[model samples]
Target: MKNVTVVGLGKIGLPLAAIFANCGHFHVYGADINKLVVDQVNQGISHVNNEPGLDELVAKAHQKKSLEATINTAEAVSKSDIVVVIVPVLTRENGQINYQYIDSAVEEIAKGIKMGTLVTFETTLPAGDTRNRFGKTIEKISGLTMGKDFFLSYSPERVYSNRIIKDLSSYPKVVSGYNKRSLELATDFYKKGLNCEILQVSTLESAEFTKVAECVYRDVNIALANELAIYANNLDINIMEVIKAANSEPYSNIHLPGVGVGGHCIPVYPYFFINNGMHEGLTTLSRKINDSMAEYAVELIEEIIGSLKDKTILILGLSFRGNVKEPTKSSTLLLIEALKERETTVCVDDPLFNPDEISKYGVIPFSNQLADQIDAIILQAYHDEYQKIDFSVFENCSLILDGRNVLNQREIENLGMKYLGIGIK
Candidate 1:
C-alpha cells in the first residue's frame, strides 16, 4: 500500500481522501485547518454536507488504521509519499484571481515534503499557475528540482456535490503532470482509487484548461437560455415548446434556464480564464453574459415580487443546485437577498437544510402542510420532493415562479395558480 496525504477537508478533498482510504491500497492521512473537521474525520464522521456513506467510510478507515485526520501538516507530510491539494480558487471582488490560499498550501507542502514525493493539485486555477506560482515556490523552499527530485501534477476534481458518490467513478478523470513521470504517477494512483477511465493530457495547463472550458461552456449556454427566456416572456411564447421543437432536429441542443447560474466551478472558473487573458489582450463576451445573469434574474424577480410586497413568498431550495448542500454562489440565495431587500416576507424550504439552521435569513421554514399559505412561490430546484408535489398542495398559491421549470404550466395554472416558468408558458 502507498502512503498518501490530502490537504483541505472541504467538498473535493474529503471524498478524495475516502476514495484512497477505501481502495485498500493506500495509508491515508487527511489534513485540514479546521479542528472540528479533523476531529470528525478522525472519528469517522464526515462534515461534507449531503455526502452518503461518508461517515461509515470515515469510521471504517479509522478503525482499520488505514486513515486518519490531523491539523499538523508536518506530521501528515512526514508520513505520506504522495500529497493531493484540493483547495479552492475563489475570484476576488475586483475580478482578480486570488492565489493566497494556493501559495500558502504550496509553501506548507514544500516544507513538509520529502524528496521523491508526488504532489498533485486538484484546485481550479488559471493556466501556468502551477509552473509560475507553485513550482518556483517549491523549488525555492525545498531547494529541490521539480522533475528530477520530486514530482508535481494537476488533476481537476470532476465530482459534483449531489452526484459525487456516483460520478467519482462514472465520469472520466482528466489529468496532467508537470512532466511525464509526474503524469504517470498520478494516472496510476487515480486508476487504483477510481473505477472510471483516466484521460491523460500532456501539460498541467491542458488539464486545468479542460475543466475551466467545460464549466464556461455550460455557463455560456445557460446564459443563452436565460436571455431567451426573457425574450419568450416578451413575445408571449412558450420557449419550452419552441426549444422542444428545435431539439427534435437532433442537431440543435438547448440548455434549460434558471433563476441564475450557481455552484462553485461554473461561476468562478471563467474569471480565472478571463483575468489571466486580460494581461494578454483578451476580451470574452461569454463571461460577461454569464456574469450578468444574477443581475438579470434579480431584475426579473423584482418585477414579479413588486405586486406582492406585503404577501408571504415561499422560495423552495437553497443550494447552488438541487439536492446538494453546497451553497456556493447559489442563485437561490441571491434571489433571497434581493427579495429580503424589497421588504418581502420570505418562507424557505429545502429537504437538505434545517429550518433552524436558516432562520437567521429572516425567513420561515416551509413544511408540506404550510406550502398552501404562501401568496407566491419560487421553485429554484427540481428536487424529487418538489417534483412529486400534488397540485392541490399549492391551491392557495396565487403565483408560482419556476426557475427550473419544475411545475407543469397546464396543471399548475389550471389549479388557479399563475405560473411564470423559465422558457415555459
Candidate 2:
C-alpha cells in the first residue's frame, strides 16, 4: 500500500484521511497542530460532531491499522508517497486572503517532501495560488523543481459538513495539475482512492477559480434574494411564497432569503476572489449587503417593539447554519454585537452547544427560568431541535422574529405573541 499523509485534520481533513485509509489502496497519516485532535484520532475517536459516518470511518481505519495521527506534520510527510494538504485559508476583516495557515502547511511539506513525491493541495485558494505562491514555496525550500522532482496538483474540497461522506461520492471531483504528467498522476490516484468521477480542468488556476466562482455565484444570488425580500415586505407580500412560485419555472433558481447568509464557505470565499483583483463591484456589494443584515434584523426588532435599549432578547441557534455546531462567520455573532451596543439584554441557545459554551460569548445562556424575562425571540438558525419547541414558555415575549422564516406563524400568534418574519407580511 502507498503511504499517504493528510495535513490539517480539521472537519474536512479528518474525514478525508479516514476516507483515504478505508479505500483499501493507501495507508493514511493525519497530521495536525492540535494535540486534542491528534489524540482523538489516534484513539479511534472523532472530534468533529454531527458528521454522520465520520466516527465509524475513523474507528474502522484505526482498527484496520490503516490510519495514524500525529502533531508532527513534517515527519508524516517524510514517510508518505503522496501528501494531501487540506488546511484552511481564511480571509481577514479587510477581505484579503490570509495565507498564514496554508503557507505554514506548505513550508512543513517542503521540509519533508522527497523526489518523485506527489503533493496535492485541497485547500481553497485564490486562483493561481497553487502554482504561483505554494508551488514556488515548495521549490524554494525543498530545492526541487516542480513537474520534475515533485508532482503538484490542485483539487478543491466540495463537500458539506453533515453529509461529507455522501457528497464525496455524489459530486464529481474537480482535479487539475501543474503539467501533463502531474495531471495523469492526480487523476489516477483520485480514481483509485475515491472511486469517484473526476472532472479534470486544463490548469491549476482553472480548478482554483471553479471553487471561488461557485461561492461567488451563491453570494451574489443570495444578495439578490435579500434585496427582493426587503422590497416584498414593503409591498405587503410574502417573499417566500413568491420565491416558491417563481422557482417552479425551469430557469428561476432563486435561493431562499434569510435574515443573512452565514457559514464558512459562502461568507468567506467571495473575499478570496475580490482580493484577487477580479471584478470587485458585485462581490464587494454582495458582502456589504449580507453583512448589514444582522443590523437590519436588530432594526426590525426595535421598529416593532419600540427601542431595544432595555429589552431582553433571546436568539436561537448560535451556529452559522442549522444542525451544525460550527459558529464560524455566524450571523448570530453580529446580532449579539449589535444588540449589546443598544444596551439590549441578549440570551442565546443552541442544541449543539452547552450553557457554559454559550456563556463564553458574553451572553446569557437560555433556560426555562429566563424565558419570563425575554421581551422578544429571534430564530437565527432553524435547527431540527427547535421545530418542536413550545412557544408558550416565553410568557412575557411580545414579539417573535423568525429570522430564518421557518417558524410557525399561527402557532406563535396563538400564544398572543406578534410574529415578525423576514419579508413575510
Candidate 3:
C-alpha cells in the first residue's frame, strides 16, 4: 500500500497512522470528524496524550512529511489505496453494539474510494457485520460491489492503549478478507512494517469472530475468578494465594479478582456476542458478576466501617486499570458515585490523571488535608506508582480496603492500621 487513509484518529487510529508513516511503508492520511484532532495532527501535535511514546511518533511522522490529517474523509479516500477504519464501536443502551461511526466512515470511503481499494475495518464487531452489513451499505451508497469493484477486510486492532506502539509491532496481527486477492493484499501490507507474525484466516467473518471470542474468553475467566473470590471470602480463604498455588499445576491459570473489570475491551466486548444469541445466558451472567464486583467492594467496605456518613475516604488511582490514563468504563467511576450517595467525603489520587481533570467525575481531588483526615483509603487501581509507595504512611485511616490486593496487610497492621483486602473475610 503506497498511500493509506486511517479514519477515526483517536486512541487506536492515531498510533496506527503514526506506525505506517514512521516505518516509511505508507504515506498516511488521517481523517477524523473532530476538528481539534485534525488540526493538532496537521500541526505535528498530539491531540491525545497518555499513550507512551505516541507524541514522539506523531512528531516524527509529521517531520518526515509522511503523515497528514483532515476532517474530510472523501479527500483522504480519494488519495489512498487502503482505507483503514479504526473507529470505536460502542455498546448501546439496550445491550447492542452500535456501528454508527463505522457505517458513516464506510459511506464516506465509498464516496471517493477507487476500484480495488481494500477497506479493512480494524474495529471489533460481532460476527458477519463487516461482510454482510458494511459491505452492503458501501455497495448501495457507492454503486460498487464487494470483491468486484472494491474489497473488504477485517483485521481487528488488537493493540492496547498505553502499549499500542509495542503491541502493534510485536503481537501477531490477524487479517482476513472478502476474497483471496484482498486477503493477500492486506497480509502483505501488514508484513511490510509490523515485523510480527501475520495470521491470515478464511473469511472476514472469521477474523471478526476471532477478536470477539478472545475478549469474551477473558471476561468469562475473570468472572469465574471473581465468583471464586467471593466464595473464598465467605469461607475465610484468600483467593489470590489459592490462585498462586493452583497455577503450580501448569493447567490452572486463574486470573486475579479486582474491584471490577474495566477498560474498552473486557467490559464491552462480550455484549457483541451476548446480544447476538451466542450463549447469551452465560455471557450476560458473567458480565453481571464482573460488573457487580465494584458494588461488592463498596458493600464490604461499608460493613467493615459501621457507617460511611461524613467519613472521609481517599481512593487511590483514577484510571480504570493500573498505570493507564484511560478512565472510560472504569468501575471506580461507579464506586465513586456509590460512595458519594452514601454521604462519604471521597477524594481520588492518580499519577496519570491530574486532580482538576479527575474532578470532572464530581469527586474531590486528593489533597494533603484530605489525606490527613482520611477515615479510610480504598486502593481501587494498582498503578505501579501506588505499588511503590509505603503502605504504612497512611497511619490515620482506620480501615484500608485493598481492592487490587496490592497492599501488604501484615505490614499495614504493624503500623496500627487495619487492612481489608477483597477475598479476605
Candidate 4:
C-alpha cells in the first residue's frame, strides 16, 4: 500500500485523508499543528461539526489502522510516497494575499521530500502560483528539480463544508501538473483515491485559474441580484417573483440576493483574482457592491421603523450559512457594527453558537426571557431550528426582516408583526 501524508488536517484535509485511507490502496497520515485536532483524529473523532458521513469514515479508517494523525509534518512526509498540501491561503482586509501558512507548510515539506515523491496542492491559489511560488520554494529548499526528480501538481478542492463527502464523489475533479509525467501521476492518484472522473488541464496555471473563476462568477451574479433587488423595491415589485418569472426562459439564470456574501470561499477568493495584477475592474466593483449590502439592510430596517437609536434588534443566526457552525466573514457581523453606529442594541440568537460564543461579538445572547424586550428581528440565516420557531414569544417585536427571503410573510403578519423581505413590497 502507498503511504500518503495530508498536510493541514482541517475541514477539507481531514476528510480527504480519511477517504484516502479507506480506499484500500493507501494508508494515510494526517498532519496538523493543532494538538487538539490531532488527538481527536487519532481517537477516531471528527473535530469539524455539521459534515455528514465524515465521523463514520474517520472511525472506520481508524478501526482498520489505516489512518493516523500527527504534529510532525516532516516525519510524515519522510514516510509517504505522496504529499497533499491543503493549508489555507488567506486574503487580508487590504486585498493582499497572505501566504504565511502555506509558505510554512511548503518549508516543512521540503525538509523531508524524497526523489520520485508526488506532491500536489489542493489549496486555491492565484493563477501560476503552483509552479512559480510553491514549486520554486520546494526546489530551493530540497535541492530537487520539479517534474524530473519530483512531481508537482495542482487540483483545487471543490467541495462545500457540510457536504464534502458527497461532493467528492459527485463532481468531476480538475487536475493539472507541471509536465506530462506529473499530470499522469496526479490523474492516476485522484482516480483511484477519490473514485471520481478527472478533467485534465494542459498546465498548472489553468487548473489554478479555474477555481478562482468559479468563485468570481458567483460573486458577480449575486451582486447583480442585489442591485436588481433594490430597483424592484423602489418600483413596488417583489424581486423573488421577478427572478422566478425571468428564469423561465431557457437562456437566463440568476442567483438569489442576500444581506451580503459571506463564508471562506465566495467572499475571499474574488480578491485572489483581483490582486493578481490582471486589472479586473468588474471583479473589484462586484466585491464593493456585495460588501455594501449589510449597510443596505440597515437602511431597510430604518425605513420600516424610524430611528434605530436605543431600540433592541435581534439577529437570528451568527453563522454565514444555514446549519453550519462557521462564522467567518458572516454578514451579521457587518449588521451588528452598523446597528452599533446608530446606538441600537443588538441581540443575537444562533442555535449553532452558545451564549459565551455569541457574547464574544459584544452582542447580547437572545433568550426567551429577553424576547419581550426585542423590538425587531432579522433572520440572517435560515437554520432548520428556526423554521418551526414560535414567534409569539416576542410580543414586543414590531418587524421581522427576512434577510434570506425564506420566512412565511403572511404567517408573520397574522401574528400581529410586520413582515419585510429584501425587495418585497
Colliding pairs, model 4: none
Q: Go through the candidates in order and give each one's C-alpha lDDT.
A: 0.79, 0.91, 0.86, 0.93
- For 264-353, candidate 4 gives per-residue lDDT tens digits of 899999888888775568888889888898899889889989999999999999999999898888999999999999999999999999
> Which should have the higher TM-score, number 3 or number 4?
4
**lDDT, residue 177, model 4:** 87
Can you give the lDDT of residue 401 in candidate 1? Answer: 80
RMSD to true structure for each model, in Å: 2.8, 1.1, 1.9, 1.0
Estimate, for each residue in 83-159, the C-alpha lDDT of model 3 and write its tens digit: 88998888865777777888788889889788878899899988998988888988898888898888888998888
In candidate 2 the C-alpha lDDT for residue 357 amounts to 92
Better of 1 and 3 by TM-score: 3
In terms of lDDT, the best-performing candidate is 4
What is the overall TM-score of model 2 with all chains considered together?
0.98
TM per model? 0.90, 0.98, 0.94, 0.98
Candidates sorted on TM-score, descending? 4, 2, 3, 1
Candidate 4 wrongly placed segments (more than 4 Å): 278-280
Query: Which residue runs does candidate 3 get wrong by more than 4 Å?
Result: 390-395
The digit string of per-residue lDDT tens for model 2 on 1-425 reads 89999999998999999999999999999999999999999999999998999999999999999999999988999898899999999877777778888899899999999888899999988888999999999999999999999999999998999999998888999999999989998998899778899999999999999999999999999988888888998898999999999999999999877877888799999988777676569998998888888898888888888989888999999999999998888999999999999999999999899999999999999988898999999999889999999989888999999998988899898899998888884
TM-score of model 3 vs. true structure: 0.94
